[model samples]
Target: MAIAVAATRQVLADSYKTLSGASTVWVSLHTGDPGSTGTAEASGGSYARVQGTWTSGSGGSLSMAELTFNAPSGSFSYAGLWSAATDGTFYDKCALAPSITLGSAGTIKVTPSFSVS
Candidate 1:
């Protein structure tokens, strides 16, 4: 479950006050390529993080976005949200189970939530 953002964790652990709205959110794709350690955030490349249309629901606790790319060029098994349009800190991540192999064109949707639980 890709729930808490890194900033949220920092806030919980160190009382940091950084926060972001849906406008700064973006999604990145990954293939889990061999010799690639999935530790740092994704960057600009074939599997770069792209911005999407964002909407708020459930009193700002829920965020939904869809990324429509002109031509799908890679295979993606994981996805995540970043705090900036490019090269920003990753906020949340989710595993695309069964993986998603893109065709010539398609869209990928992601919904990340925050709650008081």
Candidate 2:
């Protein structure tokens, strides 16, 4: 038998709210799972992590403001959240439903969201 631990709605909401309070969240592009250390992070051709602004947590979830990376060249399949622009901390990551492939002159836009259930 599995022991099921359930959290109340308020607890879920609060958890997300706390996450939204991170000081400087950075959004990183990846070719695959970022792993524990944010491996496979995209680089070169103007590719750089962008600072992310998050909406206040609500109803157990929070959303990142849309982020745009200009002139980034890569084939990205995932996005990772970090504490700084470079090497602060790896919080989490998620897969991009369709993935993004950019050439040297184009841009990539993403709006990521988080939730606690």
TM-score for each predicted model, relative to the true structure: 0.51, 0.79
lDDT of 1 by residue, 6-112 (tens): 55443342221123543446666655531233343333333456665444333224344446433254566776666666666665666767776666345555444
> lDDT of all predictions, in order shown?
0.50, 0.74
Best by lDDT: 2
RMSD of each: 7.0, 3.5
Give per-residue CA lDDT, model 2, range 1-88, as digits (tens).
3223334544554554355365347888898888888999887777788987766454455677799976366688999888778778
- Pick the TM-score winner: 2
lDDT: worst 10-residue window of model 1: 10-19
Model 1 spans with C-alpha error above 4 angstroms: 1-18, 21-23, 33-48, 59-61, 70-72, 103-117
**True-structure lDDT of candidate 2:** 0.74
**Clashes by residue pair, model 2:** none
Residue-level lDDT for 111 in candidate 1: 49
Ten-residue segment with the worst summed lDDT in candidate 2? 1-10
Error of 1 at 37 (Å): 9.4
